[model samples]
Target: METGPISAILDTTLAIIFTWVGYKTAAIVWKYTPYSYPNARINAMEAKLLSEQRFNELAESRTLQNFVVNLEDTDYRDYLTGISTYNVEEIERSLERALAGTYELMIKILPGRVSPFFRLMLEEWDVRNVTSVVKAKFRGEPASDYVMEIGPMLPKVKAMAEAKSPEEMLVILEGTPYEGPYQRLLLGEISIQEFETELYRMHYGKLLSYALSKKNDERVILEEFVRLRIDRTNILTVLRAKAAGMDSEKIKSLVIPGGSVKLDPLIHVEDLSMALAELDSTRYGKVIRDVREEVEKDLSVLERALDKYILERMGELTRFYPLSVATPLGYILKREREIRKLRAIAKLIEDGVEPERIKELVGDVA
Candidate 1:
């Protein structure tokens, strides 16, 4: 068997290709190594998240005191410790503080480059703070009592609260990410709902933009979740506006971008029922259809159904992207769900509603 220089050159070329491939594989492996520590911490925190059964247990408590006592064995205990009355306001405040603590802890423990993802996500809280401030100002009340300390807009919270009118608030809000929403507010004849709608679009639009820019697993996880949120928010806005008899053009203007489906048709629906009917063709159609009858009876039930659907989707998809943004976002959403459930349970028990009925409302939505 005789071989020429061509055969030798071919062998050398193959060797070089294999070496390059090996180096790339190693680089990919090293890129994910930093996720190991934060992933383990997220894993530990996830184990502490309340299960469906635990939510049922919390629901079965006949009194707020019993409900508070039931929470003693969970991670929430630290947040609720030494609270004597366990009043609803006290309980809600404590739950909010606990959520803020979780956000701060996640931000600190996450890899520095990826930490900004969670921080951007937390801006929803700041938007909420602004919502309360502007609404209170419009109503001639102070918002300091209602403001919750959960997001990065803390430096401007005082200014936001001190502003006596929309113009003053707009001045305080100048030169911020939130500036545009108030700028829109300055345009005459905007309802409170419309004002909040702009905030939703700005917040989710920022999140989806940043997620897409990542072009990695963070994009894969956060982008899909953000789009889901946008769709949910848009759908609710349309239905509520239709129910309130708002103008179709105004309703259309409030719709946010980034949904997987076209939501513009929803704005033109003749009524609330018709709006829900319009959803019959979207990705969310099935979830909406499944509860349409109940939704007609109680619109709050529609919110519960949609929240459960997005969460279920997140739970299903995020498993593939673990050790990235998936774990932290999933953990925070699940924690928020638990607090909502607990709040419902406490409020209903105080209202003298039966435990079964409470569970029916706040427990697993089919």
Candidate 2:
């Protein structure tokens, strides 16, 4: 039977639609299937994450010795058991080694195809390593005896550790995307805070760009996660700048380009208190608002809020794609919170800050 032109067009359109649906379904299945075994291990790891109660118990310890004894009761035991003293550096290196172990495990278990995304995620840690070395160099301190020593960024980290000063560090970073910001720092055109802000922009920009390039479940989750982080960074940056009495224009200048919020309203205000007030309507405002009084008392509270916010967002995304990259990534992010919060507790102990105060502040994460 001869069909009319409209009927033939409808048939072709239906065929195309069905083909796209089938292709997408297959792609999703393919993307997630390889992660099944990796995620089972991830699930086991996630199940072992420190409960709020445990963090509290550790925080309640009366001395650094007590905290170490308490820590020996958890998964951190294997990583920290050798530590006899409570030095902050000793604690940080042990915690970071545990983290480095996780990163290595993930890189090994992850399907080869998924390496780039995971590697990009590790860039955040690399940024921290570089900053740590830079600050140590400025203080005339020796390079950190401990570096993560993993991932493709290892060479860069090694080079940074070898540099004797910030200028030397800038020379190592030259020709990389991060060079301009560090150079500006060396030339006194930008503060370390501003330089760190640029590192974050470059990191998220790289992750978001790659996430946008892929067409899959992982991309959807990653893209959303990256943009959420960008928003978090912008929010905190604006708030801190305003509090510092930075010029309104200069405050805006530090705003990263690809965030999810319309922060212009929050960033444009000259008054710190007013700028924070303007934050009431943004997506991440609740974190700051929930701890408003504390944030007012100590600006560091906002930093902790944002870190928890970022980790919470990762957990939420992991639930959305139960069998994908988000699962392992979630474990890594949560473990990081555990490590960072632990570091804070150790630092407090080293400073002779009371355990009750530590429990009050550093016990758990959002």
Best-matching candidate per lDDT: 1
Q: Which pairs of residues have clashing backbones in candidate 1?
A: none
TM-score of model 2 vs. true structure:
0.80
Model 2 gets an lDDT of 0.78
Model 2 scores worst on lDDT over the 10 consecutive residues at: 144-153
Error of 2 at 5 (Å): 23
TM-score of each model, paired residue for residue = 0.88, 0.80
Candidate 1 local Cα displacement, residue 355, angstroms: 3.5
Q: Identify the leading candidate in terms of TM-score.
A: 1
Clashing residue pairs in candidate 2, if any? none
Residue-by-residue lDDT tens digits, candidate 2, 140-215 = 7776564655545668878888876677777788777778887887888987767777787788889899888877
Model 2 misplacement above 4 A: 1-28, 81-85, 136-171, 174-176, 183-191, 353-357
